[model samples]
Target: MRRALAIFFVFISFQVSGQGVLDWWDQLHNYPDAAGPDRSRYINLSPGYLGPNAMIMPSLPNMTIDNEFWVQALGQTHAGNGDKTQNFFLKGNFPLARDRVMLYITSVPYETWEVTPETRDERRMMGLGGKGGNTGDVAYGVIFKVFREKHWLPFNFGFRLHTKTTTGGNLTNARSTDNSLYQWEGNFSKTMIEKEEEKLLLKASLGFVTWQTNKNRLPGGSNHNQNDAPYYGFGVEYLNRSWLLSSDVVGYTGYLGNRDYPHFFRTQVQYRFNRLALRTEYNYGLQSWDWNTFSLGVRYYILELLD
Candidate 1:
């Protein structure tokens, strides 16, 4: 799997050449405290396969729909046990009475392969078994630009509230969608460097997530009692006309006394074109749940529904 991923990365790197069309990082306000003068043109970054973007798992304050609708498709391969997941996301944003207040909705449909030892052995023997598909939980949220950058402060502050529904398939054990979960997050970002065709930004966010476990049953009749945990993340983004690179570290302590805090690092590279983008990402789990993931995604701005 690692060799296949490495080869895939190399192939994509060579297939796309020249400078990127759009500053993929520029669209994210979470990197800098100040939205700057051109904030209106920036769109929110795609949440990737992890759903929300916060530390171990929360959305960042840089969420913006910018009066546009988006559709994205992602193919992800988990390095462990040779599992694979594919996802399709549809989202859009609408402005409220004020520009700082926005409403948005996101939906995901996914398919996954459950690669267990037994399943692998069965595949080797009988050539069949482990695969399932389902529509994942949906999320509806609101974003508030609590405070835009001002002379008194160098950073921008934003808040987000999201409610995720329990409506998804659980045939494979890889789904994170709960019966229902509510999340609240606060984020800040600031631009650290700016040059003619290059820019750097820093972003941080903290959040809490709580959920009901009625639908998430455990094996052996043991109740799946997951404690709510606080999550936080920090990231840096560098953007140039042809290439964009981003890296972030997020961690959270589990509620269960026996579960230690886990940290994860994710890195992404994107080649942007006018109205179109292609990206590849890798995420490494540092502690607690240990796993490596590789993902490739394609995004199209499509068309401007509104100015």
Candidate 2:
């Protein structure tokens, strides 16, 4: 069994998911007194993001869609043990409501098996069939400018609602399988002040989710977790030609769910050249379950292929 587990981990590379997500941490770190997001700072208006970027970004005016694929390898093993794991996530995002709303649908199906080695008899082990999960999530929101202060302080606000796994996933304990948390989440973020190089922010959100088992769809056979989470953000930007770098985070608060509190920290760099733009970010998490991560992504202007 140990031999088999070793082979399985080798077959799946573990370094694919270099960048993870810590949502809304950047906003709360700055503008520590606002509570809304505007226009393009979120998924509703932007193309694709694994983690929150910064408070300064907003959505584009036109509707757009982005296809994102992650090739990740996950497994766990200890000396003289046969425990193993593997998983993957792929999704596409598109905007609606004239680019003010957004939807995301994806699937993650994987196979895993584990074993416990023994000293006396031959090793006895446990293994699950290659059963995984399929998940679908949708969100919608709108943003607008609240006030335009001259030269020093400007305010922006946004409202967003999210529905989780309104569609798919099977029951298993192998990979990225969401058992349909038919829950709703509402969030708001705000920027209270901003200038050419400094900024401040505030944000809040509430979530309610009911997760019923597939075998029993009734009330008692389900689990629900709901909470109100809030945080604040502060940041500064240093401009170098067409490139900019920003850092921000919120401290001392969180959703207090399975993850940890005061969850925050995200830094991003954005560069523009003609009609092309590129972005890269490194995010730090206060949660114990995750490690610091980063990613690089790009956008291109294919006007030659446009209508």
Candidate 3:
């Protein structure tokens, strides 16, 4: 079975050898002036081609209003592709209106990357040439409760509006998109099993996410400069004493066919003691993505900050 699977993958890879995203790559070469502002016009916008923070599908927000701050050390491995990336993610949440509203901000802050010759050559060919370390975009948003759990509905309801800035650097190197992204989603959660020591809850989010794009870069050119798509996420969580476990699948799809659909599965484990928590997370990319990511972090509850 292993041999057959290997052969099958080899055959599939052969079919896409130099197609470079199935003809999209060749099309980029047609415009020799693909540089500066024009760079975003042609390069593949898939998660694999851009920075770790460029195209992210964050999980649904938990409606609890808790003052918290966290930082994570992240590493990404591209396996056979021979690319290594290291970065830090920072996030904080503060209560704005007791249990009704919360404000949050998150950013990749900084990253270092090293790619093999083959990967570098491919990037050079597509106009994203340079490498090394760079900063990532900053995102801020607000989350508010729409309905309290068990108030009128069996589930807790909330809404979130998020916006990403073009604060990231190394655009020519494709480390960032240099474009803005906005997302708004409705969130729902319901507890399924509850005990004195443990409980399970289901969570989901539904909404639209849109980002700036070059219309001419699209196949046959699009009528608009922004690409919009329906984004979604669903997951389950289990909490027992000071431990929390969760798994989720999240993604979004754009109109372009050249690796525009991106999604991934993520699992996280956390242990909390008093006002401090330790966490580790893993993400497996799916659909045109080939990177495996791991992260270790610590979270501190600053409930006294707003208390």
Candidate 4:
């Protein structure tokens, strides 16, 4: 009789525990007086819809190309708003026509992330929580530059066409948007001062970007599927034979406003020696984003050209 009573008690305990778990899940996900969970009410289809890389606006590139073949690897950390992310970035530049044209690839190959309880509840409500590690998108582009001395224009003119692929995974964990994006940018730069070992430059950029978003019902009851933005940036850079420093303000404005707009102040410093460089970067998010980020990396030049 004692053995039978023990078995009954174990069964009852399991039943209670299971029900408790179910109730908790329902509290996180269930919607009252609705056909089912209304996901549209929970996710806004903005930058916050996925990971940091989901809808990032491209930063302005310097008019000076690397003039050789080189590759870079970096580790980055982003922390804010009760969430944290760690990721690795890999990039390579290939010269297509010496100093005037190049092709490059930049990739966020892997990341691990964690969100706060409040963030988790929203993700759970949309059935996109319970994720940890995943890969991010890959961007490849072509850059073309026309030197000031060689052209009739007073400033060096450059152009870039970048496209990001939907190679990322783990949408359930909100690790990536799993969507493609495209950008077209025009850049202008002029040398304000020059010496054998030191130089100063002023640069500006304007671009447009478009990407797909989760189909969401707009306030006007219209369903939207894509987002488009116009991006702009301006910066100054100072460089010598051994060191480079730059700072820029970059951002984009989308049609939806608010969370759809993101701006940042970015700064970078680099130290260079024979065939190698050490680099550090910081970005302070402004306007619609609260996350700030830092990164450290090294670049190795596989081939170089000298004048």
Candidate 5:
């Protein structure tokens, strides 16, 4: 594990070096705003605990992506179960009618899951004992932003509809492949504090997630009791020119009852250098079945390539 991490770091260093060269060229040419797009608009789009930026249980507004493709590579470690997961994400934004309506797509190329001894034992009890290292399912989704940011009374509101497809590896036993789901969210964000290059923002979101279950494919033929759940999240972010620090306490109540709800706390820090970003985050699950996770990742925003 240590060796693999070392190698990954080496690769990141090389990528950063290449990005630095591009940065120098952009500076020399005085590239238009398209080349060095405004970072403030996307600062809150960083990935959250479960691999997407929806806070703990739901996604909320941060910044809007205009015309860009964003790529992310994240390495995650789950402590309680001694598991490791790696994720690669690709996202693109296309203007349907500029800010009024936009189409966005996000997809996970693939994820790798490494099971620990403890997990193996648990699986063995369920007749699934085997070595770890399995490729996870590929998931892709599309987001339709219904409206641009609008001031409604004291808050700015944005609405979106998103749907995810379950396409990839094993979707049954290991659960690395999840069920398909649809979500509709209303997001609100407000600037609470502002200074020269420093600002603090508050964000909140409410949504409903309806899940599609495949009970026949599950191990032991157990019926998935998942019901439509209400998702809620609250987050705060402090941003400076080159630094971003944020924390969120978010969760959802199960449709069944209070006992079935899941909650989590997440924190993240990011450093930006031109168009390259380095980030790290930690998440603590507040529920019985949830696992605590830590992740390190990097993001590169390509504004001119697709434009």
Candidate 6:
């Protein structure tokens, strides 16, 4: 009876935060604005900044850590709006599961390229001391939400501890923003699905992320430091099914170590003929002093990039 109750609570927690509540914090580093679907077979494709909304599905054969399941290879590329430099990523995962216990191993070899005014104005910005960079990491973690289908709002949160355990320019342990720290985030979704689709859908989430407090800042920037901060946001996605368009903004205003205020935004859209999900967003900088960024991403279900 006690075991059944524990399993039951696990289901309820999954429905609430979308995963293990504490695990969601990791998504903030990937893409902060894209609120993802709380379901199986989901993956967010945004490059460097993965928002809490772009989390992966927990129960796939390819996502387990042990030999319980197999792993698949996937690749992606992205171009930034400012710099002509491009970002690239390649990854695979192995799934592990047994009855109510589940775990996953994800390996991502990724690189980020950057160029800013500082690079352009080497003589003026720093008297010939400007520099650009490339950084990547291999992240592995365990994910186990629920063993069954959900009826109420479902939570799909998780944790994937990334060790700069590979080769990269910023692989030094002393680098504040490049090293490592524990990241966490959680999201809950309630569906008002009609037999033929619906009108109202709501998603609420809470997350706490502690970033390296680096004194060095981004180009034309600030918000550099080792901050063990936390933040939260809520969103509402209304689906008409016919058009299949969704518009939602998820943000947090400095909660217990919250770095910035009103952090991320995701203007959402879904396309038919191919079941494509899309997002265009604006990232805000709080008091920390970082350059604001504009981002856009498309969802390709055939490729399983559920962004």
Tell me, by TM-score, which candidate is best.
Answer: 4
In TM-score terms, candidate 5 sits at 0.65
Q: Worst ten-residue run, lDDT, model 6?
A: 39-48
CA lDDT, every model vs. true structure: 0.55, 0.32, 0.71, 0.75, 0.54, 0.36
Q: After superposition, how far is residue 136 of candidate 2 from its true place, in Å?
A: 7.8
Q: Order of all candidates by TM-score, from best down to worst?
A: 4, 3, 5, 1, 6, 2
What are the per-residue Cα lDDT tens digits for candidate 5 across 183-297? 7777766778879999898888787766533233222221353447787789998999999998987766654442335678889898989888998888887763256777788
Strongest candidate by lDDT: 4
What are the runs in model 1 whose C-alpha is more than 4 Å off?
Answer: 1-69, 81-99, 102-104, 118-131, 171-178, 214-226, 258-262, 303-307
TM-score of each: 0.64, 0.41, 0.79, 0.83, 0.65, 0.44
Please report the TM-score between candidate 2 and the true structure: 0.41
Error of 2 at 176 (Å): 4.4
**TM-score of decoy 1:** 0.64
Which pairs of residues collide in candidate 5? 54-58, 54-59
Residue-wise C-alpha lDDT for candidate 1, range 155-216, written one tens digit per residue: 77788787877666441232443356667788787877879999787888888766533211
Cα lDDT for residue 44, model 4?
44
Candidate 3 runs further than 4 Å off: 1-40, 46-48, 67-82, 121-130, 218-224, 304-307
Residues 1-307 of candidate 2 have per-residue lDDT tens digits of 9999998876664433221121223232222222123211111111010111111111211111122221212121111112232223233344333323444443333323332332101110011222222332322233322223332333223333333443322222211123232323333434555567554444443444333222221211112232233433455444465675667653322233322233446676778676565766665655421234454655443332111
How many Å off is the CA of 210 in candidate 6?
2.3
